[model samples]
Target: MKDTGLVAMTEFLRHPSMVGSAFPATARMVRHMLAPIDWDNVRTAVEYGPGSGRFTFAMLARMRPDARLLAIETGAEFVEKLRASSDDPRLIVAHGSAEDVGRHLTENSLGYADVILSGLPFSTLKQEDAETIMRVTGSALAPSGIFAAYQMRTAVLSLINRQFVDVRQGYEWWNIPPCHLYWASKLRGEGSYEDQIGGSASA
Candidate 1:
């Protein structure tokens, strides 16, 4: 397990575009991002760009016994490492792009995810690719589900806000270079922002 950190750094050096950071996410950062998840009702969870399983372990620890986790990683080395080290039957490490999240869910017999966590570096991704991934993430989550991403810049947040109806921001200074986290949920029957604000003003 000790060498896993070194492995993560090496992967990042080789493929900076795929890996989010030079170091694995700190425990504090992982906890902050996962704080809102209702494990009891989370039937399916998806992790995008899970390099070396930093948050994967955290998610597994909090997940229900019957729930399933699909870890979608594009790097072959990371995918191989996850499969080799993980003993949990509920975890399925798939080697694929984050934009293909919907397809992965359907192929695995898992419907839309209850919660989606991302470690992808949107700042490094092409604009079109980032948009596609965010769009797929928005469409792949359940109506009330949340999408949480730990990013270094606000580019990803901007994309997420465009896709999801509600967006919440968080900050974690404990990480290697610190991070800004974004949590977003699609619009359900909840009234629009204008409607809510207008009603409050009238009252």
Candidate 2:
């Protein structure tokens, strides 16, 4: 990814209809948002709403060479921009809504992924839409998979708590309005899941 890619991303982000029109996530913030991911274990990954490839490019740098990145975006313009910015064989940009995640993977015969990363504006989505997207994302993740997302101030804390055994918050104050990175893992082995939730497995 080049510096100009970020410039174009920032311009698109500033557009009025963009969910993150108020401000784009800075490089520092993107790195912090994705820091908890274990690149070594994530072979097949999906990015929901990759907007300008901020997180997309970061994931590319960290994932294995053979790893595949399926980026789902609804903006036709951003999709073109993402495709033009790079020539990585592992990357595929899908111009569509996050809700199409399951259908896209199914059509490609790509089963549960190792990791699912999202930059979607859940705070702006209707409650039913948000729930559907989360359910689809959860279903698409491997049993031991990790699902990560970022948001500016969300009641999602409660929603995540209900579905995920463990949820950790990573904060980034450098970005305008600042933001919080939420990382949650699908339940794994009995002990591992227990460890993640501090041994409280009531859920």
Best by lDDT: 1
Error of 1 at 111 (Å): 0.8
Task: Give per-residue lDDT, candidate 1, residue 76.
Answer: 82
TM-score of 1: 0.90
Task: Give Cα-based local distance difference scores for all models.
Answer: 0.83, 0.73
TM-score of each: 0.90, 0.83
lDDT of 1 by residue, 16-120 (tens): 987999898887777777765566788899999898888998899989999999999988878888999889999999999999999999999999898999999
lDDT for position 17 in model 1 = 87
Q: Write the per-residue lDDT of candidate 2 for residues 108-186, one digit (tens) a residue.
A: 6667788888777677777888888888888888888878878877756666776677676667777876877777876
lDDT of 1: 0.83
Model 2: lDDT of residue 19: 54
